[model samples]
Target: MQVFEDWNQKVKKTFNATNPEVVLTVSEAGSLLGLTKDQMKLYVDKNKLTKVPIMRSVHRYLLLKSEIDSIVKTR
Candidate 1:
């Protein structure tokens, strides 16, 4: 439980540090949304959420902080 709490605090700190132009990793996005990594991928796959490709690899994507905030507002 302590470990989980510590992880959550780290995630929150990371999220708060992000700026509008910044892009987040899958783990970071999942942390902001309170979802697992797999769940975040699922959301992307389903088109319920969107991400930006960081490179030529489709698997390497980044989420915008604005989009995350919009999702949170809707929820």
Candidate 2:
């Protein structure tokens, strides 16, 4: 019981620390943009879109939801 409580607290703290606000995975961003995952990568590489790094890992990136929304609005 005590261990479970501790783990729960830790999970809550981690979630709070991350405070994920409008972060989308590459696949998600691609879906929103009507592009395939490969095309999404290309877009990112071409600087047509920007990504937020996660855990300082090059392979893990998140797109800003607000940016996606803006693109939608423009279109």
Candidate 3:
């Protein structure tokens, strides 16, 4: 099985290189991380999270589901 960082790299590359259609919105990402929307936004602003810019003033954060799951498991 792939590690979280490896999976995150794959997803980031897919977004930046292939430009996929199914990127997660901030809200969706927050749900995965067990974080509130505001907290997620804070992480985005701090560059702790990766957000892909899809269109004019529109962006979505990319998060590995496994990474979030790991966080929940550890917590």
Give me the overall lDDT of model 1: 0.68
lDDT of 2 by residue, 1-75 (tens): 444554323433454467766566677778888999888888878866776665545576667777877877887
Each candidate's number of clashing pairs is 0, 0, 0
Kindly provide the TM-score of model 2 when superposed on the true structure, using C-alpha atoms: 0.65
Question: What are the clashing pairs of model 3?
Answer: none
What is the C-alpha local distance difference test score of each model? 0.68, 0.68, 0.58
**Candidate 2 Cα outliers beyond 4 Å, as residue runs:** 1-17
Candidate 1 ranges beyond 4 A from true positions: 1-20
- Residue 13, model 3: Cα distance from true site in angstroms: 18
Write model 3 residue lDDT over 1-75, tens digit each, in one string.
Answer: 955665444555667566543455566667776778788888667755445553333444465444455556876
Q: Give the Å shift of residue 41 in candidate 1.
A: 0.4
Q: What RMSD does each model have against the real structure?
A: 6.3, 6.6, 10.2
Q: In model 3, how large is the Cα lDDT of residue 31?
A: 77
* Highest TM-score model number: 2
lDDT of 3: 0.58
